[model samples]
Target: MAELKAGVVATLETIRNHFPSHVITTRATATGGAHVIIEDVPLGPPYNQATTWVGFHLSDACPYDDTYPFYVRADLSRIDGAPLRCPPLHSTGQVFPADNSTTDTRDATMVSRRQRDQASFVFESPLSKLIKVLKWMLEQ
Candidate 1:
């Protein structure tokens, strides 16, 4: 099997392929952190989501010969500034103030598959257009 770069660049491609309707309005600086603004489209909606400066460290066993999602992370959300809103979990294992972990929801629905002892999140949103792409990928 082939693989991709073990870093943020590959994750960015995953985001683009999964959410093509969303636009990366702003790219991060050379420092590996920046704001990604996603605009809702006609088929999608009118919501602008931003993930500012999400960390992009790589793992030890990344295969650069091919291309794929190299890193594993959780939900991406807009960072707040002293707001009354709750923060989004960067990883599914994180705990929330309501005495529940993000993993609960994930465990309830997502199937688990492991590689090299690292886990990844996977769920097919019926509303996600990525499913169409996935179907096409399987056909080919």
Candidate 2:
């Protein structure tokens, strides 16, 4: 269990280094694994209904066994005024906060949008080659 948590932390740190502009948070899932929320990236169209948001899932055994494991999902849909069960059970688990030091929601939204756009390009471009390097490091 400790090793699994370590891997989760390491993955979060790696993502933070690679995508510094994102608002990253972590939560303990009911399954005893962790879920990393990349808040601010809106789910487009169909899934954008009041209850759904998109993010990724990280586990002890990832990448090698799970290709394209960085899932873009709308699993954050809210229900009955309560958010989906992604929050940490006991306390906040904010790994990174949106850079809205002035408490401006617009600024935070814009930053998140920009980061999402940049990430899209990076993932689509040759920059994705870096994933190989990251995978190798994770293996080590």
Candidate 3:
């Protein structure tokens, strides 16, 4: 379990480095794997649609194991006043920044950049290329 958690941390760090403009937060899940929050990305009908499209492409490019180290989920309820829980200090659940702690806050710059990048990927890039890149990253 420790090894898996370490791997998850490493993978999250790599993803954070790759997407410097995006905000990445990690919270310990009851299942041992972490819930990675890609903050500032819009959630709802259209965004869910885009994620579904991406997931379809990703699934063909990589295997998804729901019981593995992690899984991607689209939680639209977050936009509708749901509070994000940060674990209490003594609890096994704890939150950490993917980057250095100082930069973890969700700000205008991060939000705008995330929105722009998401839009660009959904609209401008070819799905095949995106799939290839994501597959390559996962295989790394």
Candidate 4:
């Protein structure tokens, strides 16, 4: 097990506090961050499933660093039967792209929503980024 940074721990605490009902798991990284996954996250219109898990890497540089390219259940599709548009990264024997150290058990669709404005990125946290990604996915 790797030690977690204070910022990463704080962000994880916030996530757990907000989504009290969800199952959140973490695998600490050598860099003092963690691989996080929140299961059973509710989905909205346009999505085929009622809920799915969301995963992301909260690096040691958290709070100061933006969490990018989240992961969701790979089989996720639109209810309208259209293409997902976003590229899906299947987690078969391939290691996740972020750190290339951890292997996620679930096959996931990579959601590439990064913080565009460097000025406003200071205001973004892991929890906030996750929420924004979920909202963006639901809207798409």
Candidate 5:
């Protein structure tokens, strides 16, 4: 297995601490980073599901690299039966969170959010991005 970088490990730890009740799983990437999947994350408000799994890749570059897109369960729908405001699943049947990476057939839908300013990643860690995305999802 590839070893996780210090930044990747530290970011994972932060995520775990913030979502103590949620189950966070990780798989080391070839480049010394890791794939993080947080299970049973509350979808709250407008969403139909009470909770869904959110996953993303933390490249070895870590804080220097933006986390970009995130993934949630594929079947996500609005509670009022309206069309989902977020990006829908692509033709590949998998959510593409990055150019060549996907949610690995977990049947997830991608939330294509990119930090407006790439330089801000130093201040906006992965955990913060995840929280922000979750809040945005809940409000949609």
Candidate 6:
């Protein structure tokens, strides 16, 4: 099942004709997946404003097992980013935010960016690989 899923993603690259605008890159490239930043991607409805990134994951694990094989992820994340376009100052003619609203937006954006930068999404194998390792060791 995992192998089939991985194959589909790789096949998509071929189907898309290896279009740069059709792929997205990831921070981790252990599986040699394609990645790109795109603006207009078809998502069924024509009104969707979200950016789309479609790619495949290849299992890099050697001597793979079906139960635990190398897998590719057909994942999409919202690339929602708005510039801090605060109002400009009147006296200084500065491209600054005006009034308390501008200050508030700045504060909120800073907090959000900091939180996002500090946060990470990692799934740790919690079922205990040691148990499986022990079972394999005993068999050997």
Which candidate should be chosen as best, given lDDT against the real structure?
A: 4
lDDT of 1: 0.28
For model 4, residues 55-102, the per-residue Cα lDDT tens digits are: 888879887887977888777778999877744422322224356674
Predictions ranked by TM-score, top down?
4, 5, 2, 3, 1, 6
Predicted structure 5: clash tally: 0
List the candidate 3 regions with Cα displacement exceeding 4 Å: 1-4, 41-140
Residue-by-residue lDDT tens digits, candidate 3, 26-91: 555433345455544323432222231111111111212211111233231233353332222011
TM-score for each predicted model, relative to the true structure: 0.27, 0.36, 0.31, 0.88, 0.87, 0.22
- So what's the TM-score on candidate 1? 0.27
Candidate 5: where is the Cα deviation over 4 Å? Answer: 86-92, 96-104
What TM value does model 6 have?
Answer: 0.22
Can you give the lDDT of residue 51 in candidate 1? Answer: 24
For 11-128, candidate 1 gives per-residue lDDT tens digits of 5566667667665443333344222333342221111232211112222232211111111123322233222123121123332111131132211111121222223212322122
Which one wins on TM-score?
Answer: 4
Can you give the lDDT of residue 33 in candidate 4? 85
Q: Of the candidates numbered 2 and 6, which has the greater TM-score value?
A: 2
Candidate 2 lDDT tens digits, 47-134:
2343212234454443222212232322323223553333222112221222222232111111011123443442332114234423
Q: Which pairs of residues clash in candidate 2, taking residues 3 or more apart in a chain or in different chains?
A: 51-77, 51-78, 52-77
- For model 4 the local lDDT of residue 76 reads 79
Q: What is the lDDT, from 0 to 100, of the residue 92 in candidate 4?
A: 22
lDDT of each: 0.28, 0.36, 0.32, 0.80, 0.78, 0.25
Q: Least lDDT summed over 10 consecutive residues: which range in candidate 1?
A: 105-114
For model 6, residues 1-140, the per-residue Cα lDDT tens digits are: 12333533543344345344554332223343222222233432221224332221222321121112111112321223422223220011222121222232111111011112212212212112212322332232
Candidate 4 CA-lDDT value? 0.80
Worst 10 residues of 2 by lDDT: 105-114
